[model samples]
Target: MKITPLALAITLICVLAVLAGTTAPAVASDAGGIVGGIFGALIGTVREGEARNDWQKVNREVKTCLSKRINVSIGQLVQKAIDPTDPRLRPYMQACEQQVAEANAQLQQERRIAGLRREQEEAAKEAAAVRNAHARAQKVARHRELIAKYGAKIASDIEARRVRIGMTKEATIAAIGKPNSREVVPPSNELWSYGTKRIAFTNGKVTYVGN
Candidate 1:
């Protein structure tokens, strides 16, 4: 089977546990430490090439695992490191366990906050869509009323589907349905802006149209 990073990391922990539990000298992770130096020196005397190869493989696997499972494996290692049979591993185990608990709790809280933020954003989008639909319904109703009142000009224009120089506001509304927005600026010019085209009205009649 292909060796995974977690598998390698777990192997290292197991090795540490075995070494720590033995009657042999304590092993430190640090190379400069007496226990660590002794173990390294012993490996050099026995199948040095094979020992180095195995360590290199384990090291690579651990580095890969660290990228994705740093927090989780660290917590697991700390939890497993507290074996009472190993006096060397006992002192710091309680503190490590507490750190893991706190870290996990904080991570959970952050996820909760993120979930709430997402929910609020979705609700806001849904509310905006609802408001837009309601506005469109009201606009369609208003257009139908206008068409019922002044529909003859619309019918003529529909035959040609064209707006000439002097179409009335009601006829314009019928022909184009409704504009995106209406602007009555600077003495109320009564301009209607409809995506890439603007129509100007004077005395409720189209005076200019620009596209």
Candidate 2:
């Protein structure tokens, strides 16, 4: 009286197989087999979907219990499969806080050390600047003394970086800073090379200046 979906599907398959030139007995057997296999596959898929839904429901329940700090679900402690009970949250949090505090303290100490190093470097630079200033003041005093000793014309010539015959070795050095190389010739003569130029000195007095 009541034709189910499975019965209807089998009847349609049988009609199609018969129209396709299959014998009635062969069509009946092949249609039955095909319909049975399709139904079996559909049933298996439904059971798999139901099992997945049940797992998701259980997982949500476990998460809800943990969020509420219930610490247990379904009359049993449902936690991660690994390390189910070791290292509870409160102790773990305390340990984590201590580690954070220690890290902050170490960072502060390193900052202080870096600040001290910068201060030392600044102090060293200041000390070097002071020494350079004192040396410059001494040079000014010597230059003034030289101007008073030798006439202003000779002092001006030296200050203008000129090398002249009869100029003392000290005057020549003050005029042109220092020579690149110095060699002593035989019998107390000195030859000073300044890049492409050369100066010859005898008895501490300049005798010749030429390139």
Candidate 3:
């Protein structure tokens, strides 16, 4: 229901076509010796406007039909403009129709080229995504292999030390070594801490030992 720019432009073309048809003879007669020139100019203006309108309409129709899975040709639309009933307008119509054909051809060719470029870009992105996924999978596999090689022994050592709490700091230090770091916990009758080395004793026992 809304009148789009294309529709407005088409209306303008139709108005101009009627004006050119009615005024060409008058303008030609008034020009006298320059009648041919005036008529030529009028024909050229009408043809140009018609060609422009045809091109825009063809473009819109092409998009609509393609979206709906219907096929139509630009050339056929141009041919319809060349009405045999209006013999006086034949020359102008022919010229405008030729321009429409040329414009449509150029538009179609450009679209083809654009489609190919988009396809290439999408293919590249897909290839990169596959490569990234493969790389991540390889990394996960390597991590799992390393865990299988060392995780169980580490787990066993940690579990063994878990039960050996209640030793003095000196005794814990003697059994383990110097801790990489230490922290004090306040208020809870217990200092809970762990580090990368030695052992930490809280309330006279080894609470944490790390290697």
- For candidate 3, the clash count comes to 4
Tens-digit lDDT string for candidate 1 (1-211): 9964445545665676666666454343341254454554544434444433433443333423442443444334333432222455333444455556677789999999999999999999999999999999986776666567657566566445566678888778767768999988667469898899989988788899898
- Could you tell me the lDDT of residue 179 within candidate 2? 94
Model 1 RMSD in Å is 16.7
Q: What lDDT is obtained when candidate 3 is compared to the true structure?
A: 0.54
Residues 118-195 of candidate 2 have per-residue lDDT tens digits of 999999999999999999999798789879977777788887889899898888988898999999987889999999
After superposition, the stretches of candidate 1 with alpha carbons farther than 4 Å from their true spots are 1-88, 152-163, 169-211
Better of 1 and 2 by TM-score: 2
RMSD of each: 16.7, 18.1, 18.4
TM-score of 2: 0.43
Every candidate's lDDT? 0.62, 0.71, 0.54
- Could you tell me which 10 consecutive residues in candidate 2 have the lowest summed lDDT? 75-84
Best lDDT among the predictions, by candidate number: 2
Order of models, best TM-score first? 2, 1, 3
- Ordered by lDDT, highest first, the candidates read 2, 1, 3
Query: Which residue pairs does candidate 1 place in steric collision?
Result: none
Model 2 residue runs over 4 Å out of place are: 1-88, 156-161, 165-170, 173-196, 200-207
